[model samples]
Target chain A: MTDTVMTEKSELPVHMRRAEFDPVPELAELRDGPAIARIHTVVGSQAWLVTRYADVREVLGDQQRFSHARFLERRPPGMADLSDEEIAQARAGNLLAQDPPDHTRLRRFLIPEFTVRRMKRLEPRIREVVDENLDAMEKEGPPADLVANFALPVPSLVICELLGVPYVDRAEFQARSNRMLDLSVPPKERTRIARESRAYMAKLVAKAQAEPGEDILGMLVREHGDDLTTDELIGIASLLLIAGHETTANMLGLGTLALLKHPDQLALVRDHPEAVEPAVEELLRWLSIVHSGIPRVTTTEVEIAGQKIGPGELVVLALPAANRDPALLPDPERLDVTRGEMGHMAFGHGIHHCLGAPLARMEMRIAFPALLQRFPTLRAAGTEPGFRSFNVIYGLTSLEVAW
Target chain B: MVSDEQLLRVRADRDVCIGAGMCVLTAGAVFDQDDDGVVAVLDETPEDIDAVRRAVANCPSGALSISTGTPAGA
Candidate 1:
């Protein structure tokens, strides 16, 4: 594979080129050419892009053969816009970026709190959160942004409650989180936001320590005690806060938008409440929000789909591409809520699968129907909705809906 | 309260589990890790239907289940 160098198009990070992915069809055309192609990232870094379904899954499933933490040690291609300190903060070891032993240790501290049983107890509250947001949208009436009103708030509120942070300061968290993820922001600004979030989380954790609440932070403080350092607590809390809300928020907005566009499927979900289970699976597949699966670095020489990848090469498992692979799901592009999509990679496959998936599914199952039932005439404000420009996630910037 | 026979049966192939700990966090009574940090089944049949459902939902490895009667829990 020959390396092709190209000038950077815009100052924006490589991750922000979602609209330019129109070449995805062309990328697919070359899928079989070289399973491991050396391509220039939007930031001009040389990285290996794994395109096909089998290879993508291979990279994600084999932690022994591949490592996630190594990518953080150096500046990731698209993150060139980040300052050294910003990159350092962003690369800090949270569950998503770690592997094996350390990954196991950090993840154990969180398992008890994220349990299905716990999330089940949180379901009614999640519904309440959805309802309150929807109620506010109703009061505001027509041409309301689902992203700001319904989509963003429900998950944000739920995560805040789960982490024991007062929802009163949610606006601060939301602002900082959004800026932290913004590829267009200056590196220093992003770094500042990252530090601010950690500090905010540290304060929140301290509060939970002094007077324990029913949240995850309280549980960690009570169980791990000195075993959990303040930085670790902040790291864990920040990771959850970001992952818990950002992904679900996008799914809720995008999934609802998809349903509204496909009335028959919307009718199916609205008619049969029990269908929420299967519908959620289909929505996850259709939306495929975690645009690409998390990145992994090869630890050893491995052959995936008959193509050999050497150690130290970066591998990105494209979940969106995999979920839609014709080999796995028939008519992969169609959004069929009742379709048998049991094993789609929407929440990912194997270890490192989305931990908050149950809560996410619960939120959507309740949010979508409640949304439709609450406003029978609910429809997008216009023909086209604004979308966020990011490759890691497919998000609606503003989904204005009116009854 | 759901009977053990009515509860869901969720099991993960211990060999494939990478210890993401999603199940334990989502449903502790149903899933726990052994001293080796591998996921171990605590209750093949959960007593609460809600808990069983939650257990199934939280299994990141997709190693948990819910019973539909007949064979009465996997």
Candidate 2:
């Protein structure tokens, strides 16, 4: 209804992209009609936005045509003098910055650690992590900012533990990730944040290099010491550390709030163990916290959903809208935990699908149910929930709740 | 049906496998990931057929599939 076109390239691209837990109405209308539209991106680049379920899948599934690696090939303005090799080294082991053979090489080493068996081994620890946070919340009593007390810390702690980040570093690390994910922050400021974040991770990488510990970083060093470069280690660790926490953290915060808004759904997650699995899947699909997925660069000229695109063009997937498309499933807009396995694109699709998805899923499954069970009477209180509109990740900045 | 018969056949096309581990996460008994993040089927006819179905549905790449096969351990 309203002007959905982001007319100016310089305008803040994060403008009005929401309906609380749902995407803005304009996005749905786009998904229905055009299926694809050209829009100005947050970075001041014009890109193709593919919104419908099947069209988004086409982009995601065909990594050959839609290259994930080239998406990050743009040299940072500050580092223009750096050699191509140096720039390539910077993106070395980051999964999102890679594709196929390279992605397969580094990813294989990490996959075993994230396998369901590994997650199963981590389950008790996850349950313990969930219990520890819930215990603190219970002790703190009501009027707690769930974002600070529960949602943020649960995933933050879990990821830190998994990635071997020092618990003490979390305060500064969280602050950096906050700035990094928030698109509203100026590009120069974000570049500085990225440098600081990389420097911070580089130190940890060195520590693991000296004496590999039992964490993911340690495992990489212990197993692939001869194979990986220092930058590769840093790239992999930083990606996991940021992705691991930010994604699930928002899902936890916003997901808890979503259930609070729907007491009926909240009860299903808390009271019924059978419901927890489906509920997590449903929450992931419904929320689609990563509103717009990472932009892909076309490797060659290609047509998508009948739209033609030349080589080197940018293509963005409307993940939240795609998940909510009526064509994806029946009553797509409705938040129904009973409906699971509808093949939602929240974790995305194709080869570069989220590597931490299993971990994210496990964390939410444990955290959401535990939160509801701990505070049976949980409801919003104190501060009005403020949505973090600018952040690449969609979530509440603070969700004050009382039991 | 005999002990060696292929029962509860599950086919995995490693050609398309990106090794995201969705299948392994969804149906642990029926699917696993090799070191290189390719799909590895541990059980074709797991007790939890529904879980296997979910795994097939959840696969980011359409690499995993389930089909009828002969009985197991007859």
lDDT of 1 at A49: 62
Q: After superposition, how far is residue B13 of candidate 2 from its true place, in Å?
A: 2.8
**DockQ, every prediction:** 0.18, 0.48
Q: What are the per-residue Cα lDDT tens digits for candidate 2 across A259-278?
A: 98898988888999999988
lDDT of 2 by residue, B33-59 (tens): 776557888876677878887878778
lDDT of 1 by residue, A227-336 (tens): 87666777788888888878888888888888888898888888888777789888887667765656678888877656677898876665656666676667776778
Candidate 2 positional error at A367, Å: 0.8
The CAPRI-style docking tier of model 1 reads incorrect
Native A-B contacts reproduced, model 2:
0.60
Any runs in candidate 1 off by more than 4 Å, and if so which? A1-23, A32-36, A75-93, B1-74
